[model samples]
Target: MNNPYNLVRKYDIMLKDFQTISTSFLVKQLPTATLFVDMKLRVVYASDKLISLFCDEKVNFVGQSLFTIFPELDSKWETVLKECLTGKSSPMGVQSFTDAEGKEKFYEWSNASWYDSDENIIGAIIQINDISLAIESDVALDKANILLKQQSELSKIGIWEYDLQKKTVYWCAMTKTIHEVALDYVPDIDKAIDFYKKGHSRNAISMAVFEATDKGRPWSLKLQIVTAKGNEKWVLAAGKPIFEKGKIARIMGTFQDINEEVVAEIKTKDNAKLLKTLIDHLPLNVFIKDRDSKKILVNKSECDYLGVANANELIGKTDFDVYPFETAKLSRDEDLQILETLKPILGKESISVKKDGSETVFLSSKIPLLDEDGHATGIVGISLDISDLKQKEQELRNLINVTSLQNKKLINFAHIVSHNLRSHSANFSMLLDFLVHEKDEEEKVKIVNMLTQASDNLLETLENLNEVVTLSTNTQAKKEKVNLHTKISEIQQNLSEIIQNNKLKIINKVSQNIDIRIVPAYLDSILMNFITNGVKYKHPDREPQLEFSTEVIKDYTVLSISDNGIGIDLEKYGSKLFGMYKTFHTNKDSRGIGLYITKNQVEAMHGKIEVESELGEGTKFKVFFK
Candidate 1:
């Protein structure tokens, strides 16, 4: 395929130049590092110093996920980063982190939306400058302390120090303000320790201070403290011990109010828990699994359906443990396929089995769970049980079939009335003409006898037609379970003399207990039509062979009757196979009404018939009944 946008041609030239210029420019910039990201959250270029500063390895960064290198970034960072690439500039931010060696580090980062020569938005350029040493320099600390002394009224920050040698405490004005105390109040080290809250917060502060003073360790902790007003406040208490000649002299620290942020964070976590609780109580089956197919979470409905007491019993387990081997394999493969394609599978029909051994049909959907870097990490699947819906669907189909069968019978009835009556009336007129033309008494008597026989034949045809009309009108018949083999046995016996005279062989393969939902009379009539047709159409060259078999399908039972007899030319007469007064054979016994009435009776009981035949060989009729 040819490239539509001609991007391939452009890339063919630009990529070679990019590797040279971009790599060289990044290397020359050295410790002032920068990273270029494509729209896909992948690093298109990274400076050597950027990798060394954060990862400390000669690891390749190009073509790797930006989040893979910086996993601490969350959805908020992703949104801002993508916004930058979409032509919005992000705010300048400074992040404080710790290095692998446990040294404090800070980085200042800013984003710029970059574009290609054609004015197309390519990606975002993020420049990162290491500023830890600059921020921590003694000159800067001194300058900051001086500015703090000059200001004296910033309410969010406070400074404090402890003198180990003198066993004294000093609190700045902001510190006293934070404690809600008088500026002239005097305090010692022990009195200052009483300000922390009574239990965990006080103990944590004490431990942190001890480590700072005894081991020259700097500590940053978030804890609650009690003010002089007797109200609790959250504070960030950070301290660094000052050592002189390998002996501890003093410890200095800062405090900032963090109570509001802490409260908001707690509420966010509680909201997440509440959302999970809501999902667990929903009426569908829902579950989440990891990339390895281990269960991460399951809703209440899923747990109940799987026969597990609760999600606790399922966590960390695979489907192989909770389901049959084949079902588990099928389910796991679907989950893996969704993850691999990063696409959702919606409304897929599936089957499940209940604890009581009944089967249920349902619809399921699975979605890929992705990380901030847009990598699929797991899958979430939901299944809604549609067994009741399926049952209703089958009922509707059965009703439609019954209605259609009734309509077919109505049309055939109209044809029988018009065509059969005309034929018999014509025969009556021809017999009268013969009686009028006769000149001898013997011939006239013979004509009268022929007319009597013709009238009797017409009456017989009318009786058969009446039987068909009654079959179509009767709807109150009960559908009892009829054993198919027993029915065929009774039919064969009724035709025993005919079968024996023809030297016929009967093979009954139907199960003895196989039952079908059919009216008793309809069953007898349907079997009789096919059985007699098989015998009547037997080949002159061979003895007749009949075979009967049954099969159970999803919604019905099927009965098949096979015979080695003269077969029907379905191509020639298929459209009128069950029409009124239509016959396909030259035999005198083919009244043409047998198959038409047979089809009506079959359908009157909510059954159907299909025929397959080769002209010279054999015929097989398959009947379906509920």
Candidate 2:
């Protein structure tokens, strides 16, 4: 090891006439890695950068053999140096060396022999450049370009560049495809602008391009274009200007086909509008509440009943916001129950006292709105004004003078009205909701027909109410001994279509010899309700099944109907299972009045009914007759 300046002076006496200090300074400050080696192939004067770049710091290599400092270099280094000493400069060549950390690096070096003023060859000054970083950058740039090209193709994005100096336009392959033009189709600025739709689309694109080209600003717009094949499509056009000498010189941009997205968004908005119109036109008071019991949406009927000018006034408000404390609390409690259980509280009669102490009766149904995961996210509530029905009932009671016969008829008529109205109202709400959101024209027509049928049934029920109120007291009430097996068979035949459609197996296990003492109509109504319920709630994964069996216990004859269907949770809904307008399942057809009406009819005939069920397993209804 030697001081670099002293070592250089000792090796080349030709440098004595030169400023040794300046020569040492120039070599040390050289940006490029350089070394002066003698004809012996030993390092005579090494620049500071060369030493730091390739030689160990603690072991000075100014006087060391070049081979000793970089032994990893191959024997070709000797030939390169020997040629340089003979006045034949060596062309640039690459050498590879492994560092202490086992990382391989590349260096480019060229050798030219140095001489004194007399032109005598003294030593070789080698210039070396580290090219590892540049090589890595080149590899990374290649990968990025490949990835960008792949993405542009997949996204149907076309790139374009307009060079102002050349007055030429360049379009990528995808851009040409988007234009529905041949690959070799030359495009000018005017032709490209003409591709956009003639009206708003052309104007928008022209303005965007103007701003980008004239003001050096970037612009992105969604516009329509008519392709060469005459098909109109939506596209996203974006442009940026490249400036030269502080003035716009070129414009580069992308054109992306987004027809599918734009079309879908427009259709969705149309559907939403139609749905809102349907909901607002519904006759019943309908409102939807979020999980927190705040109203998210309300129909016109709900807003009118709540004394609001419009539905928007009622949105995001809870019952407490408009109703009295007691009324709001009651409604909130029912909402909480349905939300917690994810079950429906249907056809529940509620009485709200107004400020003037007058009562407004409403038949309200609240159904839990569930997400895909079956978790309740909100509740859809429908309430019907039944104050007029209540008034008629009171008038009938007053006119009948509280007589036992008349009261009995009144009770029966009342039950009929309650059951029928609840069923019709619930069906209306469900059908209307489906009709609103349904996109298929055929399905919507079917729903409309169903609504017409429901309307007819409701009108028939109203007519029946008037007729029943005038029934004579002399009308005899009697129970006949009906063949149980024959009755079940007749009912099954009536439900033949349902049975066939659902693949329901109605196993009538009742013995033909068995007979039951019951009113014929009561038995038919009771059997029909149970049979339909079995079919309506059948498990989706299993074939529908219903088995009717009869037995005699003590002095009572019992008929049991069982089905493999989605059953009730007795622990949660057992108490309200038979209550009017109480539905525990998510079946769209459930009105919660069938069981209530069935139970009432059974009791009217001096019969008792019992239900045994488990969620997801099935349900069985046993009716006992004396």
In order, candidate lDDTs are 0.84, 0.84
Q: What is the C-alpha RMSD of each candidate to the true structure, in Å?
A: 27.9, 28.8
- Pull out the clashing pairs in model 1: none
| Global lDDT of model 2 | 0.84
> Which candidate number maximizes TM-score?
1
Please report the TM-score between candidate 1 and the true structure.
0.55
Show where candidate 2 strays beyond 4 Å.
1-31, 62-68, 71-111, 116-123, 130-140, 163-166, 207-219, 240-250, 330-347, 352-360, 367-377, 389-626
Q: Per-residue alpha-carbon lDDT of model 2 for 1-626, expressed as tens digits? A: 77999878776876563666667778888888998887787887778888787777788667778888777767877887888899989665777767678998888888899886699988888998998887778888999999888998889899999998898999999999999999999999999999999999999888888878778789899999999999999999998999889888999999999999999999999998898889888878888999888999898888777777977787888888878888889889988999888789889998976544567899989999999999999999988899999999987875565466346646755786787889899999999999999999999999999999999978866664543343233234578999999999999999899889889999999999998888788789889999889889999899989999988888789999999898889999997787645788778888776786677667666568998998899999999887
How does residue 45 of candidate 2 score in lDDT? 76
